[model samples]
Target chain A: MANITNDAAKPERLQLLRVLGPAHVWALGVGIVLVGEYMGWNFAVGKGGMIAGLVACWVAGLLYTCVAMIDSEVTSTVAAAGGQYAQAKHIVGPLMAFNVGLFLVMAYTMLEAANAITVGFLLDTVAGMTGHSGLHQQPFIVLAIMFLAWLNYRGVLATLTFNLVIVAVAFTAICVLFFAIQFGASNVPLDFSAVTEEPLPYGWLGIVASLHFGLWYYLGIEGTCQAAEEVRSPARSLPYGTMAGIMTLLIAATLTWYMCSGLIPWEYLGQAGTPLFDAARVTGNVWLMVLLFIGTIFATLASANGCINDASRAWFSMGRDRYLPSWFGAVHPVYRTPYRSIVFLVPIALIFALGAPLDQVVTFSILSGLLGYTFMTFNMVMFRRKWPLDTIKRGYVHPFHPLPTIILLILCSSAFFAVFLGYGTQLIAMMCFYIIASLWFHFRRYQYVRRGDQFTMPWPRPQGY
Target chain B: MAYEPKKQGLAAQIFDVVTLLVLTVGALYVPLYMGLAGAAKTPNPIENPTWEALGQNAAEQRQWEALGITDPASVNDMITARFDYSFSWAALIIMIVSVVGYFVLVVRLSDREYREVLDERFGSKRKGG
Candidate 1:
């Protein structure tokens, strides 16, 4: 057996402070995707109406559920900070690992950029509501990105502590909106038949179009697995935290869908940039609107914070393994955090936040996520075959074995195609980005090999390799 | 080896069960029931008693005409009734399965022996000693 000392010592050497527990892990899982509850997901309603949109959410929920289940197993078995990237490295090879790592870095950075943009827009809404001109979006976005990146650079615990509080406030706001809608604040009649009747206004193709928006509901739940190295007990905490987090999100997603759609016309909900705020406006309560606006800010911050944390960790892992410059792998001696990577990620995100349109940024984020999911799903199947569950003391082995993994792979592939159909040019651009990244890695590989340092699979290599 | 169950204090056991139940009902049952109730309240156009009740929406009129319902009063009762029944039943099944599935999973996860095995395998090595 390859010694644990050899495989695990590198992260230990980096001296990442171990502080997170199950609760923090759960919060990070939920926090990273909380913005979906406040906005973005309503766009699905425009394409498919309430019923088709809800159906898309159901499929997405199922896909994420399968992902969380397998992720728990892989996380516990590997227990690395690299998260999915590490899993890919062990199960696939160095090339695929580099691709997965880069995909995740882009995915989280794009998600951070999207949240930064949303924060600016929501703050502008607040300003407009208070009878003033909106804040300059570029400055607001840059500041938000910098602030969250600073928090991440300071420490993981600091970032998570802020996340926990913000997530609580955001979750409370969702509950308030759901109740207010249910109690007739909007004066809109419940139309159960609307769920089935003409729910697919754009026809069957609308369901496919809804995939990207539907994905917003549970996009970053897998991020919890990325914190495996810091958690107190990954095998115990990861499965419980991830599963509980997903279940919470499922309920939150359903509530957000039902309340937002029922309170106002699906058409309006679909088009509103800040859907929850619009839903609150239907109540004609200034206080509720204010509350939801605040919630939107909190949700966006939580997402950006969580993304910065996850992105830096992935970059650090890649750097530590020599896929990138070792400069990124350095931990701050005082804070014991990956300050360099966090600082590096913020400027890239700021560029995207200021330069890209909101819809394009969102599409790129989901596209990157889908690419990473595809790799992780394949990695899980390979990992299971290479290291049978019986040999590992896994906390949660997903039921039905390979069935869930296979189903998720198929669903993810179809979602990828749906995304391609919807955003062909953007998808092509993402491929180009990956190709350039791969070529750079190839160049780096040559330099490393010449120094008598070589990249090997983290797991035991197959015979005859 | 014999399977020896760990003994727990009454308070601990109660806390475990209560936590599981609360999580199951709050997270699984509430949102599902909310969705089902919302769906039930949405008006089904074909089930309307009068053509006037279906309203003057052009989309509704086009759908009615496409379905060959020339008169609201003469609309086929079977189609509307079947749709309502199937939708309601599906919602009920989904709610029940979700609640029950969550309950089972939480209970199994709370097992003391299972937790011990997890700690042994994947707990932070720094603190394990």
Candidate 2:
């Protein structure tokens, strides 16, 4: 092979600043997902009752554990803004990379829209309780999206620093609620029998279906890799931060399941708009209620904030590679942020938040996420096949490689089945949507993409080609 | 210098705009047309509303008795589990084909494009190229 050199002078390219550490990475990942503990996970209980909900939680946890381990190993080496999209580009090729990039952007953007709508509904709920029932939610939703967009537009450091504080506070509130209900000054009573009162109400199939809501428990934890380019040291920070984020989510998911299941009947708990808030309301302690309410709002805001960060990065990366319009590729010279992409996504998120039904919005987000995880399964297999061990220097190597890959594939298939149960038509429709998108990319978008220049990593040729 | 992408032709831009409009509408309407719209919850009120009475109420107790859901083992009869899981072989086959076919196309296209990149960056005489 011919030797390559950088002796020729190169033009200066504005880039995202690398100023983050493991803590910021943790905050980015956990911030995007902590909202799950406050509201969504209880849907599993409605699907299969407490025991099945617990099973689904552990199963989804195992799925995400594989995601984190595999993502960490690959991300430590790829180290780019696009996360899995970057991995797909280097390990697979343009078509898969384009789809993965679209998946990341769609998933995070839809989640951001959902978070904004949730924030609006939350404020309206607080208003209804205070006797001001006719509050307009649109302004609140618009404000939430615009403010977070502004934060992201400022810089990554400020955005993630704010995320760290709120995420820490939100996580701490969950711990406080757990400890208070378990052994606090509150005189609130608990019904420990309520947990096991109705076990596996839907049987085995219910456990399978519950895997859908179980996803809400740790949905966006893989977002940590979106920060790879911005991290001070991708090799050290990506693995450490992502693993720590998943571990924290596991504990948080369990605590949330336990506390809510103990306090409320599975039937009512499953249908609650905000189970943690309802768990606090059952206590009749005004202070605890206020804390949990704040926790819910902060968690939603944190999620929207992180979604903006990740979605914008993915869009910006794809833009940089000309997979999309080149207009979105610009990084802010002064702020060192993906300003164009951030600004461009605000209106898309706003329309979804204000126009679409909340459930559908969330369903779209979840399915998009599932597609990304499914992509990771193949991405990991290809990464191993193309660049085997010791072929290139790796920052971190996850043990039992094929094991994690197999587990991820199984869990992903199960989740697909779960989505199919309730959303069969929607599942098929989303597949068609992506197929159309892939066709568009293949015929229309491929020419704009710099084919030879798309490979950004410094690695040797694949073993087989 | 970083690799910046070339500009698109007008036809591509028009295709982009038209496809985006179609997809956005499809994303919004397909679910609704498919009956995936969110269902409004029916208010289930109980007498003497209290935290203790939230789940264990006369109405739910009646529901439990009527459905014979007194024990955890038979609780499978509860309402949420009523989703019809009747397997449709045709639908499953269509889904399998759609997904698998997409992957097949991706892999085949990727092989061709990836080799072209290798040949451009390193001469075709190179072993992998």
Candidate 3:
């Protein structure tokens, strides 16, 4: 056996600045999931009534809590830009890491595309209300994608600052909506009957049907982890920031669900393209509606911009690791951002925004996200085995050791199966995508390994082979 | 450092091209075709205003009734049932299996013997590698 040094591994040349603090991490984390307050989440009420939707969200919150805690441990320990991809490479192997990277890229890009399309939908709805039409969704979506990609390419600081401002405004709007529903003067009084209305009006299967929309509440909370390399004192900041963000999202999800449904008929809210806007409209407060409208636009922009940042990071990581073309790994010499990766992502996102229905796009995003969660949870155990607590500089270890990971594995697997059962054909289409991706991986692996490149774990390796 | 392009054999090149084509067609063309076909089967409101208006009115009336509202023209609506029992049962079964499987994995992996074996195989050989 011969000893190997840390210098043997290639030095990181695609450098990203470590400028993000706890506040930035929290804002980005919450901002990525803030879209839940505006739209998509109401679709859960369409499947399950108000009470059932709330219950579904509660279950989804539990799943995300487990995922966030476990992910924070790995993010702090690994402190890499790839997030789950980097974690998986050390715990599992290259093949599984490739699949994880693809899943994350798909999830983030599809989410961005969905947010862009939803912006178009909102604009068209607003236009229709004014007795005008022909908003041309494709052009709007393309412009949104291009704008977000450009913002991301400029630099991470610019992106994070923009995210913080929008998140604050959007969150304040949600808080105002909650207050308006409780005390604002309106012709129709707030109804509490929906809260106790049979809980599961559609039966237990309604829970399964609602899982995807329920997941929207915390869909992109993991985006913070993808920015691991850029966070100062990641070991301390990742856990505190991400966990705070999850708690905030959980409260927002509950309040948004209750206020919107309680103020209007749950069915009307479910069918609304922008439920929060409708909730404000039902209050008969023109000012409230206008405020929420602005919030909706900003929320969409924030979520889309955040997804672009996270997705490009995943693409950049895979390219750096040689999972994809090396061109994707190129960073802007001036801005020190993953410019080529952002450019590569924009067109694909634009295509999705134009081609797919918002429902299908959102479902695909959640499905891919849950797939990534499954890998991350499994990797948590593998990471603990590879690097015991005593062996590493552990800042935050999840309480109860592996129980949370096991429980999360159960929840994520079930959610994946539920998505499959609810959306069989669409899930099949995504499976076809994975097949194609795996085929590409199979061929790429030959060249990748022939070049004598492999994933390097942060932990020490045994003397070798 | 500038990236050096890798040379590939003819067979590998052909395989890559074929897979790329298949992926492009499957991802782009099939979904687009399906969406267009589905859209074509639906009636356009512009072409049949009277029928569409009648259908819309009837839906509005039903929705008003479901909400327990007195006015038939009320915009407020109530949620209705949309569930599949088979899906619920399947999801439940999968969840149960996953929980049990994960528990067993945790128990096995956390064992002292297993840790020792893993340490011997992959743990650092010296103070630092």
Candidate 4:
């Protein structure tokens, strides 16, 4: 065990392969998020009607645009596996870093669990439809989690390449659905009347409430930064991949909203389980339905697979920094994956998938993501304050400095209010949970953490000496 | 071990472990015990309900009912339920102040410590004479 620990501490062993390019990073980010365009985002419509939903989508897009710009800037320079966690460590302090790491782990794990559960249920539904009943969801859930984990543990290139293909297929399905409906291929004509009639059924306050659900449109896009260490050229690839991912999501989101709202009534669209699939079904075309069904499944699987890659990386980074046990930091000798961290998270995710209520699981994941975004606002501010522009060679410098930071803060605070308006208790509970975890880390974990080793980037001293 | 971890007394380690366990449970369980977790209790079905099953067709609704969703309309209502819209100003203000205040404090403290590092590494900056 001691020799293994010594071996794990070697710099060569600790390093992740720099095989990933911009496309892999794009696949990682978009693979995790494209699931949103297929479902979940419509919940905003349920909260605030059609107009509020559209407004929320655009507003949320603005919030994430700020996030992507800030993330691109810091991630290009930091170029680490922990993403925002690494940014917080270098820019803020240990406590904030620990919290950010926890946020990433919890956010991605819960999301992975949610995706696995969805996959299990999807397969079970298929079974029931085909005259088979009592196909228990647990084995399928376990299988999905295990399959994805095994894929991740094998290698990064294969995993992300697979993600790229399925994500492309799912994204193409959305585009096809949009164009087919646009060309009047659907027997039913698209209806724009719903937009004008009862635009804001519940008033502007509903917009505030809807903002919480709006996040589903682009929740995990910031996850692109987790691939910083793996990218061939962190400065160039991280920014390019992240920006491209966000643009793709933006177009897909707009197309999804347009197609679903035009095809289905607002009342039903607001509460749809699978809005895109339903839209295809409404088109009265068998092939469209089949294609959309495949799209939904692929999106779910891709999300789970991406979540595994990200959560393990964040956990592995934390372990490497001594924020968690060093046992989890070990990279596989051959596969070059954070094999232990990948395996450790499997049971945690499986437990949540099997036992917890789905809505509660989703709420936990969303709140954790919200906390990460809030941290990015301060992280960007401090990063610029410490490093300045000319002090370091930034791979990509965000155009506006404090403007994006300020906008992100306001939007983040508004999202906090939106969560408060709806899920007041879970919001507070999540805060309390993080607070307790923070206390644990500050009091215990910080001592074991080495300050010198934490700042591993090849950058000069921060300014203002 | 080439890298030695910081040594702590057994009592302190145990205390930290116990505190983490108890507080973590309290943080997660109290709200759940208070019935505070049920913001949206919709069935997260993998497939979308058909139009006929959404009470658009009487026979299909019956079939759905037999399949276990006794009342599709209630489920619809639950899924489409909007927030009350009115939030307590006190809660919102407190939340904003707490978050922004925390960020401000972290930034200020981190700034001081960071400068201390810069001073150690680059030598203390001499003021212009």
Candidate 5:
């Protein structure tokens, strides 16, 4: 039998724990919320599907909580840079890990696209204010993507702080609204009666459609897990930070929905290019609105930067393992950052940025996450015996034991696949074909791993010993 | 043996709490400043019996006169929107408490933990390298 482990390859240098503290870590959580959880979908959805829209976010929140726990466990022990790919590789066989590595490129690249497009959406409003329309037109979005790409390519990461400064600043915009609510009574106390799903916005396909649009809201939480290797002390900070980030975003998102439901109503929001900004006019405070706008700009830039870092790291790992071009693994000698791979990611992301502002991109991103998450959940189950607390020194004992893990796998996987069933009939068929092709390519890459030269991947089993 | 943990000073703790509250209120500004909520409640509809009786009167031709005319010019005039409404005292105080509390606590913490953080960050990065 062919050896399955990557033992023969020289090990990469171990990462030193940088002096990142609670606040820095906390900022990452806030970044995830502002970027991932704070993208405006209330205005994007049609009126009647309001009930489903609300429920979808709630489900997403619970899912986020579950992913955080499991991710903390996986990341606390594993290196942070490679993140889910590293964790998945540990528990599952190498073939699945190979599949995960490829998809991460797809996943992260698309997320960068979503961020650019989202900023483009907000740009439309900013343009109108300056007495110009279509300023956020696709050409500008392209320029923004190129600028972002240049930032990544130009050796900016080495000196960059991990603190998501812009997102955090905008996160403060919520205080102004809270004050207003206390100052004046509500016009309506959340009349769920007016809620409708009749025309159902996008019709029977709305839920799946929204799921795609919705997935963008949860994009960058994965970055925190990837930072596990560089964390001060994973035992305390990792678990708390991951859970805290998810809960914080969940609370903020639910509150945003609850407050906005009757205030702006769905129709006006759906049609309004700058829905939130429009609402700001009612508050009668230009300074407050200015703060929000500036905060949003900060939010996008920080999130984009974080995404580039995480995705490039994933590219670095796969390249080092020989699944991708080895050139991508080249780290800057002085800076210790993956300069080349990050540059490569920019163009891939730009393709999606220039694509029409279809909600389908969000669906594709979430579907990929779910597909990868399935492998992650299954791997944790498979490796339960090997990494049991007795074996691993700092093992995380999940609060509700096997049951929650099992439930998480079932629900999260089902929801992920649910979208495919809903709208991915053709795409799923194509994906199934490509996955088969991927497996074939895997085996073909390693003739030694297959018996009788049929075909094979270097799917070596990893022995912890 | 594990090192003995240093508890944050009362003043520092106060600052931390205040800062966190500031952050919370600050974030909530997104919803507030956007006018997605906090609509001024409509005062109860003016339900005077005379006004109701005036609508039913066959003297509807003189309904404009029959109704109180004390504020005719004001009623007919185009009302301008005022953006500079006085903020409620409660709104003003809660905000002040949170912001002031944050500054005070931060000042206290600076006096206490500044040495430790500096030693850990810039000092250690320089020394260890």
Candidate 6:
């Protein structure tokens, strides 16, 4: 644990270790990465989707992990709470940092909005059973946001511990459902024929298609590092939690999903509106369906709760840095929660829920986050080569420094390529947004700067040898 | 066009609901309108040529001649004879291009923000200022 009073030892902000631990943080990672999207990836993409997604994930994963790893060295690294904002200050200076910080606030807030909508989606399912009308009414949003806000106002450690309990119960229910699906297999034909006879529906294009769904598994990864100060042994835990959640779910979830697809028959799997839920219903055991409902609801709940908590932190950090209003920086004096920041995201979340369709929100959030992952990969490479290091030198070294780093760079680049190849103009439009913002900030940050003088791009991050 | 998340306030919500309704309608209605209906129970591919011949080949012949096209209405009887087998394929293509296209767009925009975050997260540590 860090000594809070020893300001002279390392003064600017509070250290991260006081708040989180390896196990708890890993759960946070798991909470975000494990979701319906993983199931979609498995069923839709099939075997080939797994190969391509995993390969891309491996590449991008290293880059993301490297970002967290290099971060271990900073006493109070950039600015307290303003993650990328602080990192930007190091590499590009205040203007770029200011722009990036604003971008992050938008990104995380949108994510919060999307997750709140997800809460409505899950609850809407509950509403279906009771014949309730318009559960998505404004009152529900008020209730959900306020509840989440209250949960957060309780403080970081408490919020995490509460989430952990919720997540644990969720996982236990998930285990029961998994077993039911596996056991209900009356026709457990161990034949590997499905891969050959029909072969995954989309063929080559399927792999690229799968990335859309598959990438969702990696969405919550960045959140884990947001509380670097709260974590127990961040040097070790951050890396472990971030990557483990990804790799484990990749392997475990993939196998389980494959089992479902292979065993369930393509027609049934494809047709079921709620495939997992439908699968449970077919088991001839009402008990199993009940269990699956529990699993799915909890999955959505954990996602919503965990996302709101992290979203507030991102806001608080940004606010504390004076990038946004200083009001965003407020922490509950008693609970040490980001009260103002968390409260602020509420209506934005409601509007998001009320406005956008569900699938778009999910896909949009994942896409935006993966873009972040690509940059992280490049950062890892640059950090290894260009970033300066002192107190924290070697955290988690990429197995092959330059090569893996290079591969990660390519992989991250591919995320851009994948999105564009898969999306085309929409991708272009999205980039134009940031480009417009980036340019606005650039011109505003540096008045009357010529294109020739714009040769230099941002500043430094660390690497391990 | 430069894409912003919401064009205006209430308009955004209206657009969202409208877009979703259209997409869902398309997803559902397209298949019904075009998807192969009443696929004459395709028997498992078997070694028996007579059974196979009795199925598609014989059925295809009926499709052309049954319309009394002995003189063949200008176009090749074979062309019309060819069963309209591509409706389902076309429908599948549209559905896929749509769902995947929708998300890919979302992911790309998300990536832009994500990348900047990564740069700053790391950039902060490098300078140590």
Best-performing candidate as measured by TM-score? 2
- Would candidate 6 be rated incorrect, acceptable, medium or high by CAPRI criteria? incorrect
Give Cα distance to truth, residue A262, candidate 6, Å: 3.7
> Taking candidate 3, what TM-score does its chain B reach relative to the real chain B?
0.26
lDDT of 5 by residue, A145-206 (tens): 67655565554323135344555565666555545544653222333332642335445445
- Considering the two chains of model 1, state its CAPRI-style docking category: incorrect
Question: How accurate locally, in lDDT, is each candidate?
Answer: 0.68, 0.80, 0.70, 0.77, 0.50, 0.47
Top candidate on lDDT is 2
Native A-B interface contacts kept, per candidate: 0.00, 0.34, 0.09, 0.26, 0.00, 0.01
- Model 6 bad stretches (over 4 Å): A1-17, A36-85, A91-111, A123-142, A185-194, A263-275, A388-395, A444-465, B1-129
Worst 10 residues of 6 chain A by lDDT: A448-457
Position A178, candidate 3: lDDT: 81
lDDT string for model 2 (A112-176, tens) is 98888888887887788789998999999999999999999999999999999999999999999
RMSD of model 2 against the true structure: 5.4
- Least well predicted 10-residue stretch by lDDT in candidate 2 chain A: A1-10
Report clash pairs, candidate 4.
none
Ranking by TM-score: 2, 4, 3, 1, 5, 6
Give the CA lDDT, 0 to 100, for residue B35 in model 2.
Answer: 66
Error of 4 at B34 (Å): 2.9
Q: Compared with the true structure, what per-residue lDDT tens digits does model 1 show for residues B1-129?
A: 212223334564345434422432232224334442111212334655564553324443333443234576554232232111112445434433532343233223222222332333334234533
TM-score of chain B of each: 0.30, 0.50, 0.26, 0.51, 0.32, 0.33
TM-score of 1: 0.75
Writing each residue's lDDT as its tens digit, candidate 1 over A1-465 gives 011212323533556778888889988989999898787888777655678678878889998998888888887777777788777655555556666776777778888988998988887877776788757878889889988888888888888989999998998999987887667665334344556655666677678767767998999999998887788888888888899999989999998888676555554456568888776765666788889888899999999999999999888877665555555667787788888888877777886788666766777788778877766665776667766765446667778878888888878866765555445445544554555445544443313311112222243332222
Q: Rank the candidates by lDDT, best first.
A: 2, 4, 3, 1, 5, 6
How good is chain A of candidate 5, measured by TM-score?
0.82
TM-score of chain A of each: 0.93, 0.96, 0.93, 0.95, 0.82, 0.77
Where in model 4 is the C-alpha error above 4 Å? A1-12, A124-135, B1-30, B40-82, B101-129
Candidate 6 on B1-129: residue-level lDDT in tens?
111111123443344334433432332223235432111222233333331232323322322232222232222322212111223445445434643453344334434443344443443234433
